[model samples]
Target: MDQPPVPPAPTEQGEPVALSPPLLHAMLEASHCGLVLLDDMARVIYWNPWVVRTSGVALEEARGRRLGEIFPESAGGRLHQAVEESLITGLPAILSPRLNPHPLPLRAYAPDGRGERLFTLMMIKALPVEGGARRTMIQILDISNSVARERQLREQARELRAQAEAIGRLADHDNLTGLANRRLLSELFFKARSRAKRSGRPLAALYLDLDHFKPINDLFGHRIGDLMLVEMAERMKACLRGSDCVARIGGDEFVVLLESLHHEEDAVIGAQKLREAVGAVCRIEGKTLQVGVSIGVALYPRDGEELEMLLRQADAAMYRVKQSGKNGVALTTREEGGWPPFG
Candidate 1:
């Protein structure tokens, strides 16, 4: 290896000495980053030692070659376009890693012993020279670590959003049956009531209680009772419309909301369907367990304008059904003179 030439030492009188061409070339080669100089025609005029080492291209072979011939992948890419723009406008243009990551194929050894290496890229600009010819200079940088960090951050953000959604669902839904809990049901009731008031449609709230529930819990364990409640919730859901809502208020008690009813009779029909669905015989653990449901119905605007009032009236009627018979449905007659005729 030949040593690069150095500037002559100043005379004893302290006179300035112009640096020689060899010394200047040595200085450029000693740069830490990859450097390349291209003529107006985009042919490589000079390349630093860093470029040769990182790109694995020899200085003699890279000289006077076009960048496209050296790196074909960058021929029609943003890096090439940036060079053209700089040459034409006599200004520099930066290629962001976000839009154009890994524009160059040049690679550097990883710090770890692993064989993996990160790719490098460059920022390009036009450099004005003598004789009215413009040159393009490319300053290379390594961005592998930055890209990896950004990807990690995006993945973490996605996981956090998913966890937040799961928490929200847990807060608003019954854990055992996945039905709307009392809090969620209250919110839905208010929304349904607003829609009914605007469209002149009737909404029905049915308060349901499982009859003979204590005997089943005492005969079998609470586990069996819980399974029965879960099955009952599914059956109730099957009997309701898509717009309807079913909620487990507490142990052995559930609420069903029927919205957009054209007639008050529709509510009675819905309550009967629910009663039949719950009253059906369910066989669990090789033992046939027969249970019944007593439901009280309250119509919107007719029974009461508020959710609390309507719920109270429905509860009162449901108790009346339980008093008369375990498996039956009843309509509230608080506001009306007496009980309406049941079809």
Candidate 2:
């Protein structure tokens, strides 16, 4: 076979000789990035081998064609405007990946043919020539790996936020019954008491103890007892308003806070509803089990001013109910020489 002729080397002069067409074409073909040259009319005067390999368009097919004809989606996009601006102003224009990511729908040279090519960052610059003809040079670089890493980081951050929220809930709530624990109940009590004082409304604290809960726990396994406590919490919550607070302070013992109460009678009535709700039969593990709650009511500013004082008074009142009989409500005040029954 005959060998192709090489262009003559320049002498040891000030500037090297201009490259021949074949030499320039060979250099552009060896480039890593996609390179393209467009004339003043935006026609593809030169499309390098890199573009041919990446875009799947041969040089002969791309030559003398407008960019829109090659990539119809790029007709009015940033890539097209960048080329026009560079040619008109004789300056370079950039199409950042953040702003104009994926100007071309070029596919990746994947071995398994599974993945698409990453978005490309492009630059358009004016190419100076001796003939005073306006030409634009376009350069494209792929940035898919960076975008994928950023998305992964965002997903990790979202997971971390969700874990933090769950930790906070666990710290404030009882793990078994999913109700507010002792620590959180104390905080809520003070806040509710302050609001009641400011509004001149009564706040009622009902100290509730599940009657004969230990026998159930001893007869059945602790698992069934745990289920009973969970059911008890749900029924107690159902008997109260949304504004009311319910907390499981300890095993088989819960506290209910009724805020903005109009009268002490309302607290007695609420306690009755709670006792009835809890006394309902529960079928767990194919066995029927029944339970009752002994609730002691204490009104704010009448029973005591401070939370500890009111809690103590309510505890004493609840002891009275337990002494007389279980499954009933008792108020701190004895209006008619006996604690009236609201149930």
Q: Least lDDT summed over 10 consecutive residues: which range in candidate 2?
A: 333-342
lDDT of 2: 0.84
Give candidate 1's TM-score.
0.81
| lDDT, each prediction | 0.85, 0.84
Residue pairs with backbone overlap in model 2? none
RMSD of each: 6.0, 7.3
Q: Candidate 1: where is the Cα deviation over 4 Å?
A: 1-32, 89-91, 110-121, 213-224, 281-290, 335-343
Instruction: Please report the TM-score between candidate 2 and the true structure.
Output: 0.80
Report the Cα lDDT for residue 22, model 1. 88
Please provide, for model 1 over 187-290, each residue's C-alpha lDDT reduced to its tens digit, 9 standing for 90 to 100.
99999999998999999999999999989999998999888888898999999889999999988899999999989999999999998888899988887997
Error of 1 at 75 (Å): 3.0
What digit string (tens of lDDT, one per residue) describes model 2 on residues 120-179?
888888877548889888998877778788789999999999999999899989999899
